[model samples]
Target: MVFFMNIRHLPSVFFLWLSISLLSLGGCAQWRPTTQDSVKPASTGDACEPGVINLNRVTGLSQIIPELKKARAVVVGESHTYYHHHLAQLEVIKRLAAENPHLAIGLEMFQQPFQPFLDEYIAGDMDETTLLEKTEYFKRWKYDYRLYAPILRYAREHRIPLIALNIDRDITTRAGEVGIGALNDRDKSHIPAHMDRDVPGYEERIHPIFDQHAGSSKRSFEHFMDVQLLWDEGMAERAAEYLNQHPESAMVILAGAGHVAYRTGIPARLQRRIPGKIVTILSSDGIKLEPGVSDYVMFPAEKQLPKAGMMGIFLEQKDQSVAAVGFSDESSGKQAGIKKGDRFDRINGRKIREIADIRLAMWNRKPGDVVDVTVLRKGKPISVKVTLK
Candidate 1:
């Protein structure tokens, strides 16, 4: 009944530059560097020292070994936009896989719709070019291909299976549109009862970016996470089903850090199903060793931003156009009928050259505020008064 699958390799260039910039900016919050002297390897047969590190605050990587040893599945959390976090996770998988050959790598990148393509790629039935085309997210992230390519090559060369564990994004989007509570009874039956419970104060914890752009998009980014969480739960259920059928095998799931965070995440759900399973978190802040649910945390030597800022208006150099992007809240550019191709000639009475300048010009504005925008549309100058949402 055991199904063997090989891990798929993805290109890694996209994350490298991004991580470097974030690290340099020092914008990532609550980050501190870990020196070799500060972190020591866990000793065999030694119980984790109590009070060795404060649980509420930051901790080192070696503290969670006891939990790691008991895990049948290890899910490493990562921040998709951060290069350091992704690199750290990849390194953790390599070490864990080397120690345990039965480990199979899984990914949140490939959706359910792409499973057949993934299967073909893993089976060596598809060529690299075709495989690249099928998994296009890799290109968008600009991650270096070599980092993930080696892992895929390792799986193929060593006969390890890589599982694609994700629901199709379209399905996820539909679920969000209808609200998680409105799914068909049959579909609802497939989800765990506990998952249906309304998360208390869920809206309070939403990042600032979501709060700002709630009006621009039908579903806010936080709502997107809610949908993603449900998708993750389904993915966990499927992974468990696969594992139950193959009791002798282990799985390593690669996903964004948010999906793998110990609390309210896939690792939490997986641990609930398989109590002794280990969960690891890898990030640029250095590895964290969480007790109880999480077995180990690995962080790189570098310190980087914990998360990327939300999408908002950015000034484009060509034509000085302000475009909306990232995960941010605020009215500017496109939401105001500012076409992507339009040049922002002026904001108010001043020439707009950068986002900071725009913000400075409109700092006191509220949601119902109005501002004058002069745009060069097709070489014709036009003025429009855009009211903020």
Candidate 2:
């Protein structure tokens, strides 16, 4: 997870805009694989080594699974926007699920309040669109659904339990604004019972990242640290609760690299609740790691998703419609005579009331595809044909 903590700068909107922005940016790390000693058993605490095993080779995966299977929980880290990272995550989940009949997948994307929606999706009670809408996925976890669709679909197909391992964003934002003690009972209910702020090396690890975006203010940094703790501890507690309830099952957790790397984030907090075997794997293009970063490091080749259609316009929700706030240099809508301040009424035949609606309308569209768009210009509806480019 790229920690772009630019919170103090944006006062008009809640902190969620910056949070979503950080998640939207692509992961920055590059991959440089180096050889080390032979693979060893996956061990946590003091016994873990700083070795990274390359999963590209056949033997690398074979050597790791035996050790991974022995663990009660397996954590896999990912760069949210990276297609290859998700592919590797799915591969790991599939491999682990093949052997463990009671395998469950825990997600950091969805909030705990929306777990029922996930359960409904897995139970075939609703379609993908309904699932996304009910969970407020586009509003909360703004990353492209295409990046995670395969894993979600696979879980649904196999009837695998998908655990939502995050608390509501509102609670975190409120906690950041007012200290944990200032929060009301409703917000406090969502927080973990134990928010261990004294985890060894956690603050030291977060300091460098915090310094980059936040100025030299001890108060701001402390607030930032508080928010980070809430994130890790909240997720860990949710995961632990599920595992405790279903001791017969094993879970594969998928979260950002920052939370899993060095075992200082979710993994350590989780260990506090249940001292069972836990293994972590990090997928990176190029991220340097010290000893005990993860049990295995997978080096996947650079892969790209097929280009989606581009409108080249900045959109925002205004009143009851989605408004075109600005246009990019090569905006297809601008070329089609669509002007700024025009509100999107519909794309093709689908209603466009929000930013997510636009994405849904154009999800499968390509650059060369021509789309008929209806926009409200000063309360009058006008139709325009845009050739996406």
Candidate 3:
């Protein structure tokens, strides 16, 4: 659940999400994976073209569906903010379902505590707002929900099992702040011992990145590594556990690309615990995707179009209205005088209560368009005009 950053960018990469506080505050940075950070490089391998797949003990590049069916678990990695990547993932799921209908989707976004919410949501017993709020989606995962809608819609339509496969963030944060020594007997119960399996390749890449950034640091790089492994192992263990419980079902595990890239994060850890065929697929995203980095790389063969535009504001359902919690300072929302803590009442004359409503309203809006917004500021309703940048 880490932000995908191209290390080649260096100091400029820090500008994407890194603030002065992030470099200074150790606990805040490691505890939350929301902010941008160094992405580990792929393990040793030669360069391969987009369509080719460097799979486990395989020879040459392979087609998507054929190779997907061959695995007991196919871990597809995603950058939470990348909307198109999730569409690519949905395409994979659609193709895989044709071969095996008894499919399960394991998620890294939702914590283990909210397994019931996922169950209920998948059962079609709850609404989207309830599901998001109950799972603490706003608190834990701040990415746009629209990016995940396709997968969720597919799962619900088919009534496929959705497995929640990560431990609570608080426990993971504790492991990152202090080593595993800080975990009490209760915390130990949440994660199994097998999560400590060797991922030497991951260590190779993450170590240098951590060292490069963590100059004169008080905390050890190994501590950060421990937290990541804790995350990887917990997810892998839970996925294995689900497979063990539902032997007939094969899974398409959705997680951050870092978790499965080069097979160092989850695939290897899961293999150490339970021996079975596992594969990874990730987005090329115009980056130099090294060979053997993943079983398959997904993107347009010719080119990738830039993502669509919108008012750069992070919203959450607040009481009867949607509240703004974050904003892209350079975006139009800032220029239009929309501030944090503003509760939405109307947008372009349509009542707005959820994020989907805003997306629907903005469907026809272009980059330089102005957005008419009404908000409740300081308990008084007010109107604000925002230009979408």
Candidate 4:
């Protein structure tokens, strides 16, 4: 399974945004989102537990939303690689925004440097692709942008403000190497005045991840820890800053669950600095659900962790129905009996309608595991078996 640590979650180097921004700003070649369905009713089960609540339970969902609607700020936690978590987040935002029209959506994907571009995008002054190009979306965030397109669209359609909530990666990378105390006046200006990082549960959770990336600076892990805390607190600080400017606006923050977990990451940091009522909602993708961290926890109907598995095929999305197979260049796709123009219907039993669906099904499968696939070749369903690699 693809593991997501609080520090290294979803795998990308910190503080490299400035360099990435200088690179080519070309948009992704094949960014496509599938048609969305009507909101299915939430599934529920017996959940009186403090930490874990079955999302399908109407009683649980009902109890959670009122508190969210009443808050000045709400944090919705997500696993970046999981599309379903994004869906759940959109649903929560959709429902809550209806109740409170003064809602602003803050994104973790776009950092502080691209705030102007995001503002332009939200203000209808620029197209989404241009905004993404200006923001270096592909290189900076690295996640498939289509997974986030729907939520962004809803915000744009609703005229909701999109707040960029991260600091530049160059500063993050610099802090990781030395310490925040070593920052020059220019870099220091970007950070907040105070970060109470000594929160009890955070160090125990983030230290090992920081250690792995610390290299020879293991002795200076405290410095690296400062960088990590700065990351969380930086986001929290930005969110709080936005709320300060628009006290009537109820901000819905879109961030990785790691930052929102246990109310010990960004939520903890934000509460110390801001006076508004804050609520944390965590979404799970089959990682052991930790309870009592967020005010409400949402679990998708399906539980799959993204893995480093490979199908070795490129899929082209054809409208809302299916992703047609395109290339098989002597990789796993060739061995899997997947021919060009085959329409994918399912992988390991997970239904496929787009390239993201294929990623959802195959991202976490182990390399050697054999799985069954169903595809429509020439208007007929066919079964093909492929061993993951």
Candidate 5:
């Protein structure tokens, strides 16, 4: 059994509760599934039959029902930018809440600073519109309010404890600037033991995603790993605290897919501290496990949207030298004869693959840079000299 600590705060209690929830959710045990444990046996064609107890697969609400019964906590992995994933998570939460009266839903969106606002909304101290305006990121992520409206509504109507589990973005940015290793021992003391060591195959799993944002100055895989570890450690501790306070209730954590996986992730770190706590990974596709740690792995019978745009585009190796000509104030790309899908072979003798490189070359230059942009126009290479903006 996982032991949780009870700590109360004033109006600021919301932040404390949110932090506690994050820590608890991050602490799932690591486990892997075998070929025999996969969904292949239970799935028929591309989908599973409704009302069947497919332990190897979670095709519909019926399959998820049984899994929800056994675990004290459920962690749903999501692609943050995908509106569909958010919708699916809300559906699962609604089903779980209905099935079990004493259920709490945790979110990765709300940070410690925004906890008071969340508390006010949940406590009916503020109106829905005010709360929504306060949490603009939730609205701006996809410019769709409907994505988050359901969860907020459910939490308010049901009086369910909506736990906020994300660290402040500013803190994350600062951590990124100063490498995790650069942090003093005292500062790094909060990190979990599992995170101290490099797990085999962990880098391999992360590299593919990291390579996608290879050129961005703000995108650092190491920084991401560091912030993730810190967030997971904080979340695990908080979850234990929440469980301590509400032993009768079951919790569900909604976070990015990368943080919820059983091996070399928040779940594994959590399992290290708490034994016998059943950790499950929920994804749109079949759940990938880390051998012997997770008791059950479940995937929803839903199609997942592609992961792009929020992090930016990932160019294929062949499309490396690609140039996307978006209108710069609706003038250059359109009026100056630049079109979309134009391949930029070179810019003033500097071979370019990504848009970042082109921007860097143009930065801080005089009005007339005399930069020659070589474009592959209709299978014919053409050089056009354009002045810097």
Candidate 6:
């Protein structure tokens, strides 16, 4: 199983959940079906068939691409951890890149501030390791790098420009806590220049889900609203800016399903800024979506990455080094002479000074890989070799 730990305050969980129930009832999106089996025009009030799109089985890419190619921007949504969703995203990107001479990929996984490193990586001017470090991938978008490694590798190999399309988490966090009005000027600059605070049907749909959470007071809900808008608007602005600058180029956008569904989030916001067709595609992870949810819903086969290497020990961050605070059941570290309070000095010859450094060292490693770890045990350096599990 892949584990992801966010280092900063995360956006609202409800937004991440995508309010399937609300979307299922009365969401609206502009989508045309290329095949008779794809989608049929139905009443928006038809609750039985949301947006009138067939939601039963997977739709083939051949039937979907004709409509997708007509759009200036195509947004592909993922469930983040579900590896197959990423495969679906990559398939679309590969097809689109092959046809469009000038193609760019916009990623919600990367923050807007790190575009330079992404540019360098795709240009082959920087190595993968340096790109991960410089962009702070392990610290920010903390999903196992292996899940996204294939997409990143392909982008770099093909020299496709990758656009970073997210605001920093700190900015979103502060906005959620104190509202956007309280943010300082520098932080404000990172947000969208103009926000559509009252997006049609967005608040009404999201409010009920917001109320289900523990702290659903009106004021808290306002804060939640602020965070969601900031994420959608901020990312939309970045993508629009890029599209406006290079009007001839087409972009494949990779983002969470919540931001793509119903075209009310990033897709709608981006469309408002740029004059062109924008198509939204969602990969179904057994998610029952309504008709206007996206242009096409792909049913992809299941995919799983190889199990990540694990030391099987809990770590505590010390000032100079990371310490073993505890061990999991049947921990390999404990079996290999590692003890609680032993501070990590190095792993596989890479200096391990922080949690991020440890994650970097283990990024490409798989289960059963053995490595030498140096630890400071009682003022003496001790070397222990352990098999990762």
Give the per-residue lDDT digits (tens) of candidate 3, residues 16-50: 11211122221222222111222443322422312
Best by lDDT: 6
Clash counts for the predictions, in order: 32, 5, 0, 11, 19, 2
What TM-score does candidate 3 reach?
0.67
Cα RMSD (angstroms) for every candidate in the order listed: 15.2, 10.8, 11.9, 17.2, 15.6, 8.3
- lDDT per residue as tens, model 5, 146-247: 446667887888888877666556655567768667766755554434454365556566677667765744447778667766777656555555665787
Considering TM-score, which of the candidate structures 4 and 5 is the better prediction for this target? 4
- Worst window of 10 by summed lDDT in candidate 2: 13-22
After TM-score superposition, what is the CA distance of residue 35 in candidate 4 from its true location, in Å?
A: 37
Model 6: which ten-residue window has the lowest total lDDT?
10-19
Q: Which parts of model 2 have CA positions greater than 4 angstroms off? A: 1-58, 317-320
TM-score of 4: 0.64
Which candidate, 2 or 4, would have the higher TM-score against the true structure?
A: 2
- Give the distance in Å from residue 244's predicted Cα in candidate 6 to where it truly belongs: 0.6
Per-residue CA lDDT of model 4 for 4-123, tens digit only, reads 223323222111111111112233222121101112222234223222222222223444576568777788888897877887778778888888888999888988988998888888
Ranking by TM-score: 6, 2, 3, 4, 5, 1
Stretches of model 1 off by over 4 angstroms after superposition: 1-69, 135-147, 181-209, 216-226, 284-295, 302-389
By lDDT, the candidates rank as 6, 2, 3, 4, 5, 1
* TM-score of each model, in listed order: 0.53, 0.82, 0.67, 0.64, 0.55, 0.84
Give lDDT tens digits, candidate 6, residues 91-146.
88888887887889999999988999999999889988888889899888888887
**Residue 109 of model 2: what lDDT?**
95
Judge candidate 5 at residue 61 and give its lDDT.
Answer: 47
Q: Once model 3 is optimally superposed onto the true structure by TM-score, how far is the C-alpha of residue 355 displaced, in angstroms?
A: 13
lDDT of each: 0.53, 0.77, 0.70, 0.69, 0.54, 0.79
